[model samples]
Target: MRPQKIEEQEMLNGFAKLFKEKGYEGTSLAELAVVTGLKKASLYHRFPKGKEEMAKAVLLSINEWVEKHVFNTLTNPSLSPEERLKNGLQSIQKLYDDGNTPCLLQAFSVQSGIEVFHQLINDSMSDWVDAFTNIGLAFDLSQSAAKEKATQVLIAIQGSLIVSRGFNNPNIFINSLTNIEAMYTQE
Candidate 1:
């Protein structure tokens, strides 16, 4: 890739991490400029709509990544349930740093709020649940059972993320994945 494109992607990754750490309303243009090593005017030159545009780009990038990695890993029929679940867990774990980091969906949905990004957040989560549900179904779980298991898995993951972040413990998150994998094999 071109040097300019690489720099642009580096900026986007920086913005995404900042938003993950600080959320939309909590993040500031000055901070973004600092993070990206660009002046405020240059940031404006890159994203004409300013912080909102930058955040939207980050969110869109996140969705694309999740679709390709997490969602596709879960729903890939060519992979066994064991393989699918393992790959999905691995991808998601990396995304959140094994639960040390907050999920972009939760961070962006926090109190201050960005109404425009709400649909993106919701769709991403729904896609997760649907992917997990599909995995459950592949394991021979009843439709209702599969949906229930999917919900449980999501709850376990998000809850573990909270615990891991709060107590500075990533094992809680890792153990949650272990339990989720058990959903298929131990049955």
Candidate 2:
């Protein structure tokens, strides 16, 4: 019955930041409490199922964001395909903090986290591929070509993110996005 101290979105953002920095197994209740400015008991009060529940909430929050900003923008009929691609990439850049932040999906792919989140991860990835495939279709690519292009785009983003982080360079990530735009927008 106590009033909430932190707002829901702010709390989730804190949880997400820690989860992104450290995988589920590496993240701890103490660390989560410190990041969120919430006591351990308060977090337990909010997420009775504990770390798993908190991780699920964070993933769900991220999924909702992508659905709205990325998928919705890509599929909006009012915008031209090039415009949609530009907007979608902007959203993605924001999502990753221009490669300074690691991917939430990759963070959760460690053995312990993946076992619990495999289906959720798989389904979310499929949704990403499907969204990009729609964009490829808009550019007049055949169905098979569109799907192949979509998969390549996903691979390129993931690979570039890894290499960018490894090399301590955001330009690699930015250049990859530029290449992706050219791949689709070029005649």
Candidate 3:
């Protein structure tokens, strides 16, 4: 991984936070420029395609972070399935507690108002589902069962994020996880 210049990293992080909080449609180029402490012209100099380019860059940054942090931890060979799931849930909860923001991917999908953004959203979601399915398979779930469970877990997570955001309660996410666990144990 190449090290980003501090200014570039700051821009990416600012965009990620803004995108998470405001969604794609709600955030404007001027607002993004202000958040990054750059003039609109300077922002454009760094991201020539303008807001769309910045959005894509923000998504890519978040995607890479998720893969390196959450996905990698969930798929670590030394962890048990329960341990992995718990850690994943905890990581998500921490994100909510820190910012009270919705999932960046979901926010972008709902607010981008562009067909290509929809395709990008689908691709990102598929990657997440595939990762969850791989983790389930490591726990001896059959392929179909793993996929199904992975889908359920993803749904639960997204739902929990919505609920947590609305209610301002991070524990709602843990409660949702309890429900997911119950589904797994129930005959």
Best by TM-score: 2
lDDT for model 2, please.
Answer: 0.91
Could you tell me which residue pairs clash in candidate 2?
A: none
All candidates: TM-score: 0.92, 0.96, 0.86
Better of 2 and 3 by TM-score: 2
Residue-pair clashes per candidate = 0, 0, 0
User: Which ranking of candidates, highest lDDT first?
Assistant: 2, 1, 3
Per-residue C-alpha lDDT of model 2 across residues 93-134, encoded as one tens digit per residue = 999998888888888876563566998889999999999999
The residue-by-residue lDDT of candidate 3 on 1-187, one tens digit each, is 6543447868988898888888988998889988877788888778888888999988888778777777887788788877776676566556555436678877887856778788878887888788888777876789999899989888988988888878888678778867765555442
Q: Predictions ranked by TM-score, top down? A: 2, 1, 3
To one decimal, what is the Cα RMSD in angstroms of model 2 from the true structure?
Answer: 1.1
In model 1, the runs with Cα more than 4 Å from the true position are 1-6
The true-versus-predicted C-alpha distance at residue 115 of model 2, in Å, is 2.8
